[model samples]
Target: MKVLAARRRDAEDIRFLIDHLGLTNAEQVLALCGKVFPEEEMPGRARLVLGDIFDDS
Candidate 1:
């Protein structure tokens, strides 16, 4: 969880849109996650709550 937060912060610090892509909608966020972390192949339709992104929804 900490690692994820740290990497996200680093991406934001560098102003990398592709890395820290939490726009204002769930749909876009899901799509961005798919492109950013394709190897994980995260389910694009899963609900995204606050806190850990890997937490079971």
Candidate 2:
């Protein structure tokens, strides 16, 4: 349950990056995630979310 909620949050965060922040690609997502979550694994998770968005498109 926690994992599912986290995934949902990641998707929302990625949407914000793409829609509001104008981030449209993996490199942009990774770069922003690196800055926001420097010591965490969020960059990878963000990439997965971004990938899912790409797959959907």
Candidate 3:
């Protein structure tokens, strides 16, 4: 679905921002998401992706 693809794109964008901006902390990345995506939907999407990507390994 289009929404799923959009979420994936958002996740990739968040990953790019974190990596390219050298944000090594999940909290920091989330804060950036707060700025980049002030709307409720995208921030939530970013948070979900970030949670998975940054989870303890």
Alpha-carbon RMSD of each model: 8.0, 4.6, 4.9
lDDT of 1: 0.41
In candidate 3, residue 1 scores what lDDT?
22
Write down the TM-score of every candidate: 0.37, 0.58, 0.51
Superposed by TM-score, candidate 2 places the C-alpha of residue 27 at a distance from the truth, in angstroms, of: 1.8
lDDT of 2 at 7: 75
lDDT on C-alpha atoms for all candidate structures: 0.41, 0.58, 0.58
Assess candidate 2 and give its TM-score to the true structure. Answer: 0.58
lDDT value for model 3: 0.58
| TM-score of candidate 1 versus the correct structure, residues matched by position | 0.37
Q: Per-residue CA lDDT of candidate 2, range 24-50, in tens?
A: 676775676567767756534545666
Predicted candidate 3 versus true structure: per-residue lDDT over 1-48, tens digit per residue: 222233765655656656778877777865665576666344355556
* Clash pairs (backbone) in predicted model 2: none
The 10 consecutive residues of candidate 3 with the worst lDDT sum are 1-10
